[model samples]
Target: MEEIRPDENTKPLTWKQYLVIASLLFGLFFGAGNLIFPVHLGQLAGAKWLAATAGFLVTAVLLPLLAVLAISVSHAKGIYDIGRPLGRKFALAFMVLIHLTLGPLFATPRTASISFSVGLQPVLPAKLAQPCLLVFSAIFFILAFIISYQETTILDSVGRVLNPIFLLLLFVVFLLAAAKPMGAAHQQTVTAAYHNMAFFNGFLQGYNTMDALAGLAFGYTIVSAVKQLGKTSAKSNAKVTASAGVIATGAIGLIYIALIWLGATTLKHFKPSAEGGTAFNQIVTYYLGDFGHALLATLVTLTCLTTAVGLLAAFAQDFHRSFSKISYHTWLAIMTFASFVTANFGLDTIIAWSTPMLMFLYPIAIVLIVLSIAKTAFAGDPVVYFWAIGLTMIPALLDMLASFPPVISQSPWAHFIKELQVRLLPLAAIGLDWVIPAAVGIAAGLLVHFYRKRPKQ
Candidate 1:
């Protein structure tokens, strides 16, 4: 094959080209996790679906899109490079956190639960489901290993094939909801503040999906994809990459909105239960009948299966890179075993434990993304990130402790912080004691930046 060179003088990517790039990113970002969260938010928000969905979109859709843009703008080679401003230790931890979040502890096992529940369980008897799930996950991971080894086509092909199927299933569900919305139409009950605050809540929830971190890791994949699509110049590729991001964000947003609408309308038929997975199954069966349930199960399983494979591949790749002592196969085996154990806890339990930790981590992740994209102004200074993140850490750690107190009774600092929040701080809500600290960190970073830039005598 001949070598292809990127033109130094490239033109802007056309709209058609941009949409394809966006669609590809959207496929990578949207999967089993994307389906349940917004739907649940819609049901809770109800007439307030618009407000809740708005919040949901900020996190679910917008932040991930911002992450992709950050990667493109920074042109970072890896996750650490994008987050390198936070100092070497912080960057490693961020990498570890991002990988683990998207790995066996959370996203990987989630694949198993979502796949089995949505895809496989409907056909099997309750007693047989667990065994069947084990068998299915084994085969699934093996295939993922083989395909990922090739590293060229499998992920792309699975995404291309599955994206349409997933969209079709969603459309069928939405159509059924539209033809006969579940409950009597009620007036929307969204408060002005909730509506106004939608952006922050949505941005925060974006953490649940873990796409922003993935964007930092996988932005190059997108840049390469842009080049392959004939935008082979630096300027053209940059424009194309950005345009694709816009396209992906728009598409994902539309689907999220539609699902939220469905979820809000679904309340007319379903109740607000704590069980997200079961609730999803119930809603699908109710609206679309047996066929809908079957279709949903299949779609969820396929999407989750692909996602599991992808995560396994990522875990293996990152682990091998981080510690060259382990062979790639060893890393895969380690992750697979971990995933099996974690998957047993089930999706609801995982999501429950995950939420509070996410509250602490999400803000830090957001700051990293914004800073990475705006790295030019900061001159890639680690001190700026170090102090900013160091300040944020106090609150993040406090927030984590506040979420689960009994586990850390020995720590005097935790005790002091908890007492301080109760006695002195005016928090926005119970879980977010970190808001004040994050603001302070931002202010500190700006002051330091200007001070360092001042002319010496």
Candidate 2:
């Protein structure tokens, strides 16, 4: 809890301090999902890696950067602030949903499950995998619980030691893969989804990373860390927060590119597999032999652990702050239990079930972030926020329906609704049915705002 302050005559923080904060932010954002998705995309995209990655960067990198900047510049206390312009009830509801999605409901459990499946499962005997997962998850959440228990030092703990190790291990993997090509980057046939619109497919695929949502979740934490570093003024905090975001962005972007290339090169030697974890495991094992497996396991565990700790701490802190009757330690304990149980469901099931929920939530989060950042352009009107998000829900709902299990999506009623959505809503096929509606809502809201403020005729 010690706030590091510089002498009045000195700069706010040295370059070293900024690097540490950036490293912490990187650690907070880069999780197991980050590892799996891009590699999968690379395997799928084959020759279209550049176009696909460009689109992936928009949502995966740009949106996250913007979310951090939006939170800082808005001077919001937390994710709730971004939604406040919509309405208090809406703010609370949205924040709770976002937190749960990013917490026990999906992302947090996923970190443990993915690390287990990708890192640990590959090395374990077939029969031992399930039991090992249970054991690993228990230990994983316990570690997260202990780290997050002392929330004050979360930034320093992750930034100083954990992140550097994760980055160094990852860099070694990337460098080895780059220096020695696995195989020629042959042009394989593009998958059905990416056949023509690879970029947009990549755009939608980026959603799987869930980093943008994390951006909103972690924004307050980043801001608080900047303040802890003695950048207390609103403007100063925003500046440092943005700087830290840029540093994290650069680091994440480079790693993503490297991973994508690594995945692509594997296609020449191995066919695209259904599970990214499998493909990733093969690549590591091929390049570094058994040694690479241990290194990857270590890398995945540390990366996922850092992310889980940040999320558990963030969620516990927010809920405890909101409901003071329940202590932060109690909430952390509750979350740890919930996440441990959820992680036992296994990574694939968690991902399969969570996709529909993410489809529903991500658009709303994106619209909120965009409007929050552009509040000045709309004169900070709450009406704009309300209308835009309200209108967006229509297509977002359709998107959720589209991603539902076949039992639901293939039902007669569901088919009729989806058919109607595809016919009426632009970009429905691409899973972006919300865009046009949101645009119209923004226009309508702006007109209403101007009309309401117009002088008497």
Best by TM-score: 2
lDDT of 2 by residue, 191-305 (tens): 7787788898888888888888888877777877877777766567767877877888888898888887777888878889665888888987887788878878876787788
Q: Rate the local accuracy (lDDT) of all candidates.
A: 0.70, 0.82
Instruction: At residue 328, give the lDDT of candidate 2.
Output: 90
Tens-digit per-residue lDDT, 350-394, candidate 1: 776666566667768777777776667877676667766776777
Error of 2 at 392 (Å): 0.8
Superposition error at 49 for model 2 (Å)? 1.4
Clash count in backbone of candidate 2: 0
| C-alpha TM-scores of all predictions | 0.86, 0.91
lDDT for model 1 comes to 0.70
TM-score of 2: 0.91
